[model samples]
Target: MDKIDKQILAILQEDASTPVAEIAEKVNLSSTPCWRRIQKLEEDGVILRRVALLDADKLNVGVTVFVSIKTNQHNANWYSQFSNTVKLIPEVVEFYRMSGNIDYLLRVVVPNIAAYDAVYQKLTQSNALFDVNASFAMEQIKHTTALPLDYAGLN
Candidate 1:
């Protein structure tokens, strides 16, 4: 992607609802070419999908918890089963496999401590986890979905 494409992606990351004409004007491009670039980006899988950002507080799910999981089983079948189980739980928004003391990490959102406990119980019941640790987030200082574009060498 060129500089203009990077600019387009930056703008879209901030607000996907921005009109194509407005983005085109800001990026110093006519409407047609800007629109074409956006289409190409989507086709190339650069622009995955647009989504509405919801307020967690307003939704009554402000509490955020980070869960660390360690398991003795590292087989592919066990991993697939664990992943499928986690996917079924709506409270688990993000899950990652890391290299360290913890085998997996999960970001869970819930209404309160009770709800989080319920999720924890559900998870433990679904799969065998050797160790599980949870930490509550006291404050969310900064949160964003925007990816850094400088790494793309478009700056």
Candidate 2:
């Protein structure tokens, strides 16, 4: 991607709902070229998907907890089962297969601790986890859904 593409991405990350004409103005490009660039970006999979980010608190999913899970059985079958089971749980917002101290990390969102516990009970009983540890977020200092832009070193 060129400088204009990078600029377009940055603007879109901040607000995907931004008009093509506005983006063109911001990047000092004409509407047609700007629209073409955006189309190219999307076609090339640079711009993945556009989504509406909803407020968790307003949606009654105020509590967020990080759950770290470890399983003694590290086989492919076990991993597949675990992943499938976790995906079925709506409360689990994000799940990552990790390295080091944790095998898998899950970001869970619910109404409160009691609701979390209910989800927890369901998870453990699902035959996917051998051990699970959860940590609740006391305060979110910096939470961003945006990825960092490092274009300086790029050739």
Candidate achieving the largest lDDT: 1
* Candidate 1 local lDDT, 1-155, one digit each (tens): 88999999999999999999999999999999999999999999999999999999999999999999999999999899999999999999999999989999999999999999999999899888999999999999999999999877545
Global CA lDDT computed for model 1 = 0.96
Candidate lDDT values, in order: 0.96, 0.90
Off by over 4 Å in 1: 153-155
Could you tally the backbone clashes for each prediction? 0, 0
Residue 89, model 1, lDDT: 96
Candidate 2 stretches greater than 4 Å from native: 151-155
lDDT of 2 by residue, 22-84 (tens): 999999999999999999989998789999999999999989999999888889887787788
Model 2 C-alpha RMSD vs. true structure (Å) is 1.6
